[model samples]
Target: MAIASMGTTVLDCPDPRTLAAFYAAVLGWETAQDSDDDWVELEGPGGYNLAFQRSEGHRPPQWPGTEHGQQAHLDLDVPGDAREEAERQVLELGATLLQGDDGGRRSFRVYADPAGHPFCLCYPRPQDT
Candidate 1:
């Protein structure tokens, strides 16, 4: 028997509502009815729940460095052909590109959210390349 089933994935941020809003917009999710300023939850697709909690002294992780290494990250899969468009959309949505802009020749790109958390937009590798 399983001891416990999976629950929401919680992230600590300076402002829960703001971070939650960012993810909601990026994922096309809706804010949970019980969300508040200190704790906000997004109703993610496929019955998954992503939540954010306020941390007064929150410190964002530093990408590609161990000073404040990324404790966790999200990998959003995008079609190889649509990777460029996805990159543009994320940039417009307050995401800062960290790497993988070599004329879209790479299979994945890294970006930092408004709160400075690192995430990746991944593309499937070509089978016959």
Candidate 2:
């Protein structure tokens, strides 16, 4: 069967430009389109495109224990040895630790972006022997 590629991943946020800027800095992406207040697009690595939509009264997702639930989240790729520094960098960039960093028991770390959208900085999973 022929396969298809996902065009773009869109997220809902209060300010499209602000959200786009945050993502651009995090992912080292460039803004492809952000000339309007209602929508903004940040060009991602490869063909992956991320668009932020202006969501009125946008309520950020709650990690479990809540009815809102996690709207969606991004799992960022980070080298195993670089996770520590990455954690520090993301925190400085306004990410709030959500989970997986309480005692470093997990392979991945969870954080919420400036707009309260959740994302992760993960060490690459090892291949099964």
**Highest TM-score scorer:** 1
Best by lDDT: 1
Report lDDT (CA) for all predictions.
Answer: 0.88, 0.82
TM-score of each: 0.90, 0.86
Separately for all candidates shown, the number of backbone clashes (residues 3 or more apart, or on different chains) is 0, 0
Which regions in candidate 2 have their CA more than 4 angstroms from the true location? Answer: 1-4, 125-129
Tens digit of per-residue lDDT, candidate 1, span 1-129: 999999998898998887887888888999999998999999977899999999999999999899999999998888877887988888888899998847657678999998899999988767523
Pairs that collide in candidate 2 are none
lDDT computed for candidate 1: 0.88
